[model samples]
Target: MDTVEVVCSKLVEDADKWRAAADGMSKAADAAGGLAMGAEQFGKIADERGVVSAYAPLQQTFTTLASGAATEFAKIADTLTLVAETYLREDQAGEHAMRRLEDRL
Candidate 1:
């Protein structure tokens, strides 16, 4: 028989860090959105189409990337937290079972 040990606390700690990263990404997404708004306003006053054309695509791309990164980071954080919780629950259940078996002896 082999024994395996899992550091569930470590998993949860890592999940918290991932969640923090997600928060940062969300802030970036907000910043990108703000820039897009400013660019839209500036485009209205600009005489040339080149500046507007260049910034429009860039704004859209940045907003999309930031939003996507936030979503992915959040998913990673959630998964890590869930894995840690599940492991902890199962370990407790096993311990309880062992205690019950010992009580029967």
Candidate 2:
């Protein structure tokens, strides 16, 4: 796969990992009313990385498009990346918040 596709695939993979981590965190947080002592906070890194992985090139794509340097496929990729990034950032922020809570607990 091309670099852009490869990056997106990795981001998607990382997003899945983050989603799993978020799921586990939700369960733990629900059970403990937050995180228990010694519990590791997870997902934030993956989520954030996933966002960057997925969107960095997307922004690039748009920039290229606006500058008339992008082809149709690149525009499509950029659009997809923008949409994907939206979700990824939300998840990342949630995970980050969880991490902060864990740290405080």
Candidate 3:
């Protein structure tokens, strides 16, 4: 059906957008981790209380959290792409079967 085709097209488009967003999220996470480490180094140079040592755990925690978030984002993007492709394939197959039946009639 034309409606099914249209819906599938939209789904594929949305999936592509999601994939792009996931990539952006990963880049952001990487940048954040780099910035946090840089800040830790800077703190060590400027502080007497061994701030870097004290803050190392917090920085590591943030990096880990960001990494986890990026991983989940990638997984979500993959799922969206797979679901869109599957729906489009099924819709095309049904249309093809209908055409064959129509020819027999």
Better of 1 and 3 by lDDT: 1
For model 2, the superposed segments whose C-alpha errors exceed 4 Å read 34-105
* Candidate topping TM-score: 1
Residue 57, candidate 1: Cα error in Å is 1.6
Q: What C-alpha lDDT do the candidate models reach, one value each?
A: 0.84, 0.53, 0.73
lDDT of 1 by residue, 1-105 (tens): 323234777787899999999999999999998885444566665626467667878998998999999999999999998998888789889999999999999
Worst 10 residues of 1 by lDDT: 1-10
| lDDT winner | 1
- The digit string of per-residue lDDT tens for model 3 on 1-105 reads 468667767777776777777777677768767765434466646556666565667767777777777777777777777887788789889999999999999
TM-score list, all predictions: 0.81, 0.31, 0.71
What is the lDDT, from 0 to 100, of the residue 69 in candidate 1?
98
Each candidate: RMSD to true structure? Answer: 3.7, 27.3, 3.2
lDDT, candidate 1, at 70: 97
Model 1 bad stretches (over 4 Å): 1-6, 37-49
